[model samples]
Target: MSPAQPSAELLEAAQRPFPDAKAMPPSVYTSTAFLAREIETIFSKEWMCVGRSSSLAQPGDYLTYELAGQPVMVLRDQAGALRAFSNVCLHRMSTLIEGTGNKRAIVCPYHAWTYGLDGRLRGAPFMTATTGFCKDDYVLPSIRCEEWLGWIYITLDRERPSVSTTLAPVADMVSDYGMENYVECFRETHVWDTNWKVLAENFMESYHLPVCHADTVGGHSKLSEMECPPGLAAFNYHWITKEASLPIGNAHPSNTRLEGRWRKTTALLALYPSHLITLTPGYFWYLSLHPKGTGQVAMIFGGGLSPEFMADPRADEYVATLKTLLDDVNVEDRGCTEKVFRGLNAATARAGHLSYLERPIYDFMHYLADRTTGFDRSFALAAE
Candidate 1:
């Protein structure tokens, strides 16, 4: 469990077959070096989920994020295209925008430099005096951004495959859910006092639900009813079938797209590198994680409803109820994940064996090893 050997230990655990697989070494969660390696090999190269595409429905609608220390902006352009660009201003290197809002133009707060919705430099005050300055010469550099099944994903690495290609398994698995039509109702961001992977691993499995979420989402959860199949190369997933604790967690009465067990089924998806989604029949919510060093994680949390529920007469009531339920769920998760981090940092902390219910965590460990240590392991798990 020495910090110096975390990657090697992680690789060994990641290569172990299921049922005999042990938990990752504690140092993997507490080591700064391991985290730095992940930032380079994982976050920099992976397709990161930003939020729902519906959140940027109008021209100039924008949201900003810091991806692996690089500021990025995703916005809807005047031409009705979803675009991603470097948020740093071209002239003075100041951030061109702040927070989420609809902007007529991207204007730098430090100077009067302005860019159009398409990122073309449009104006600069008193810049005529600058030698060899041409307004047309400056344009914010673009980053790769794509929309797959209603989610917006961006990446800094151009060599990475398209989000659609990488996450096709997820799309096909949830095809019946019509995830693209699920509208986003809200989005929020928070920084939690835990390693990003700790929060991610917590979200990847439901074994802790009975204890960690006893006051909120755990009441109706039956561990035996949850399915933890092996994960695909791009993501890991599990299923739960039950009578939903909330009405909207099941299909809305008007929904005709789902049949039989699917009407009451929910899919918990961990899209690698750090996008976790809980997609129910009538609603969906997700978390996009970014590490702030090894001790804190920045999270983008959001959720929304399917078309059937959105069109229902009690749509407003359903939204309110869903929001409150999610808030409660987050409170429980934060407490649980933070406690795990504290334990991970302890001198006596050690990894234990993984239960059958923690298959996703096992798959995730492989992903971490694959990225950080260049451990070549096949992750194309067949569906059971």
Candidate 2:
């Protein structure tokens, strides 16, 4: 049978052209069936950033993530190569690991089935007695994993292009930041009470900044000063150039390649499917999204000073102050998005017209439309 589809209103919104476009319909945010389609069609096929490779610099370091319906874990093998594998054990389907940590081997807690960091089966305490059983035949399923600019990405679909290929446009724009050298110093994981789309849309435009972030980062740059250009196949970015009034918002110590107003510029990006980042000359921050369901999203946030800032004596003070500022920003965003989630369910709910400043949002909707419906312009899906 053909898979279910998003609502007609939503499919229409997804295909709407920019400037004349409206926000996505409420059903898109609240429909469980549409969420299932997105999970299988979009999230399952995208090469999404999970975390920093530096966390796995040593052999045996591992971290866990739930991608779509799969329980996945990425680890460093004895040769220091990164590998991603199903975290489920072959024996009785038990989850092999609980959380992030260092381990010499993955041992299933239920039956003690052991596997190497490379995902090869090494042992099964009682499986030898089973007729025709062999450790070599029971390797943990593996997925495609790659690293780019310090971030580790994994795609359940092996046919997906290299993450670098998908991110090339963004890579060019962010190359001057020396991003691969910036180590992760602060990290946070949380499940927000909102749709993943709500959080992602919140970051796609600066329209709400003046009202939503008045006390923090709102007024630093006016909406007119921001630039939202078209994005490539896999991602989109907007430019924000402004001087800071916050303690850690000053020009970065390195002051290397950025010239003119760009010295104080920042790039906020949305990597289709669900990766968001804010890259600045002095520091960087990211929010990696995973939808738990229609109403919840798993958010992974990480930030640190730039490589140049890390070498300065004020690095400690700057990072500490930046962390606080980010925390405040998070608090405000959480409240705003959660309320928006509830508002999406209102009987009076309907999509509003898009603002000119929300160009990235329009691009994101196009990316979603193309992937979910297999057409760049619009999808006219019929009932199966």
Candidate 3:
């Protein structure tokens, strides 16, 4: 079947509660059954960002990742074409690639069976003469892969809708930003000891900026300065905050280009279910949140923008300031989320409420609800 596209009516339904004032039930964050359903229905079927295209800059370059518990390998073939496949060996079901690296061909470590970059079986020792064995019938299963704004994305269900059709609004947003030319500067991994949903909820709203990130990020950007751009696409908010103070030392003068008091921070272009692309003043950061279980999540953050900003005299200073801000926010957020986890764990707490300012969080929940239950006839019906 062809991929599903967001219809104008569906989009309109998604935007119905535009400036939403309602709060979401706490179960949305703490339920294990909900997480399982999300893994099965949402993550498996959606277009999720895995890594940047630059990671596979040359032929034979590859990266191994797991999404919704399914191991996947993203690689460029000998012909330099990008592709994605289940990272499992067809013969013994062993993982083909352990981690990210460059390889001419993938050889299952359990057995010597080898597969080419295109995921076609290149050789299977001792299997050719086996009774009822057909090499032609055994090739690594392929997954749907797509690229956008230098990022690589994949979907587990081949029968699901195409990535482009599912994310047309996101494409339009990227085009508006001239993202093709935006360069990456730095990418790092962050692991949070809480449910992935908790982290996502924290990121979806700006209500905590004033109290939680006051030291570094709050000093720079005001809570009221944030803006939520319209559309159903995930992670589509924008904020322009002012720098508390100028550079303290002469460590790097190149960053003076961004010496102004105000700093623009986009919530990050989220493709849905997992990938998050955050664009700062001089750099872009992409994060893929892989859920391990009810309370554990592997957050892979990687990506770097161009080095032109670094070449400037104060570039290092600017980068340092931004890094400090992010570090402070992460620390603060992790602490609060950990506390939230404990709160949700309490048997006494039955339900929690979302604030009116946290509309983005509700939007996300509504989207998940629509996708999982299919009870909201408005979305699917509107698309008609």
Candidate-wise lDDT, in order: 0.90, 0.83, 0.65
Give the winner by lDDT: 1 or 2: 1
Q: Candidate 3 has what TM-score?
A: 0.81
TM-score of each: 0.97, 0.94, 0.81
**Deviating ranges (above 4 Å) for candidate 3:** 1-23, 174-176, 185-190, 233-236, 241-268, 310-328, 350-353, 375-384
Q: Which ten residues in a row have the lowest lDDT in candidate 1?
A: 375-384
Leading candidate by TM-score: 1
Angstrom error of the Cα, residue 15, model 3: value is 14
Expressed as tens digits, the lDDT of each residue in 115-216 for candidate 3 is 888888888998867999877788888878988767778888778776667776766654534454554445566677887877776766778777777775
Answer with 1 or 3, whichever has the higher TM-score.
1
lDDT of 3 at 167: 71
Worst 10 residues of 3 by lDDT: 1-10
Best by the lDDT measure? 1
The TM-score of candidate 2 is: 0.94
Ranking by TM-score: 1, 2, 3
In candidate 1, the residue pairs with backbone N, CA or C atoms under 3 Å apart (3 or more residues apart, or in different chains) clash, namely none
Which regions in candidate 2 have their CA more than 4 angstroms from the true location? 1-5, 247-251, 377-384
lDDT of 2: 0.83
Candidates sorted by lDDT, best first: 1, 2, 3
The true-structure Cα RMSD of candidate 3 reads 6.2
